[model samples]
Target: MTQHILGGCLCGAVRYRLTERPYNSGLCHCETCRRTGSAPALPWAGIACAAFAITQGAPVAYRSSARVVRSFCGTCGSPLTYFHADKPDKIDVMTCSLDDAEAFPPTEHVWVSEKLAWDVLGDGLPAYATGERET
Candidate 1:
């Protein structure tokens, strides 16, 4: 049996469902993620593009970088998903947006080179200084 995961934006303006389980669950401390989320790090799960679908309202997209696009709810400014043009097969969803976020714990830390000194999450998971571990 397939377990579907559901998530949405803060104001419920945008909703989504993952038809399959996510992988590469991790915390990203990259500068882009930090600035975009206004936080020290962002927790994300990788879902195949084909398995992800918008179930409700449309999300506004921002071209955060040449290779990446971030989507959010325009009304509530709640971050939703992250996509890389180079990797169209997968999309990263904010773990916090999930209906059962506690079920998806991060297994590693990525972009540790940009990690803030004060923001320490003592999970002792494998840390990647720059890029993520190849899945």
Candidate 2:
């Protein structure tokens, strides 16, 4: 049986559902993610764009960078998803927004170079200084 994942914004103004499981679950320590999420690192689950669908209110989008856009609940200010124009097929959903956040565990840490010294959250997972893991 396929498991369906349901999530929404803080105020429930925006809700979404994932018809399939997500991959590339990780914690990003890049400055962009930290500032956007107002946290040391942001946990995300990468899902195919086709598998994700908005079930409730629409989220406001902000062009964070030249190729990146972030979406948040306009009514409740809850950060929701991140998208890169270059990778239109994939969308990174904020793990915290998931109804059952505990069910997803980060498999790796990315952008460790920008990771704050105080933020240490690695449970034996692979760490990458940059986006792609060094071979």
Candidate 3:
């Protein structure tokens, strides 16, 4: 049996589970992610939309961009999931929100072109100027 990976919002108002192992775990330094998470970068783990489930309370959704929708807990304002219409089959869950965040460490850094000047990438992870793909 596959072990479920559980996570939730800070206040526990929103709970979610990943039915399968996540992939493409990375840190996103895009401006939108920085603004939404109020951090230099946002770490996320990607999984099939069918593999993710919101098992508890509903989260408030915000259309952060024309094709992007971000969800967060209304009670504690913790960012939860990010959905991009371009990749309808996949969704990214905030790694920091996971109950065992340390278990899903990021293997790469994305959107480095938008990374803050002061935010150093000393972790030695592969970094892409834009997305994960090489140009």
List clash counts for every candidate, in order: 0, 0, 0
Best lDDT goes to which candidate?
3
Residue 95 alpha-carbon offset, candidate 2, angstroms: 0.7
Q: Write the per-residue lDDT of candidate 3 for residues 1-135, one digit (tens) a residue.
A: 279999999999999999998877999999999999999999999989999999999999999999999999999999999999999999999999999999789999999999999999999999999975796
Off-target runs (Cα >4 Å) in candidate 1 are none
Error of 3 at 85 (Å): 0.4
Which parts of model 3 are misplaced by more than 4 Å?
none
Question: What's the CA error at residue 106 for candidate 2, in Å?
Answer: 0.3
RMSD of each: 1.6, 1.2, 0.9
Name the top TM-score candidate: 3
Q: How does residue 109 of candidate 2 score in lDDT?
A: 95
Model 3, global lDDT: 0.95
lDDT string for model 2 (1-135, tens) is 287899999999999999988877999999999998889999999999999999999999999999999999999888899999999999999999999988788999999999999988748999999978899
lDDT of 1 by residue, 1-135 (tens): 377889998899899999988867998999999987889999899989999999999999999988999999999998889999889999999999999999789998999989999988688899888865655
Alpha-carbon runs more than 4 Å astray in model 2? none
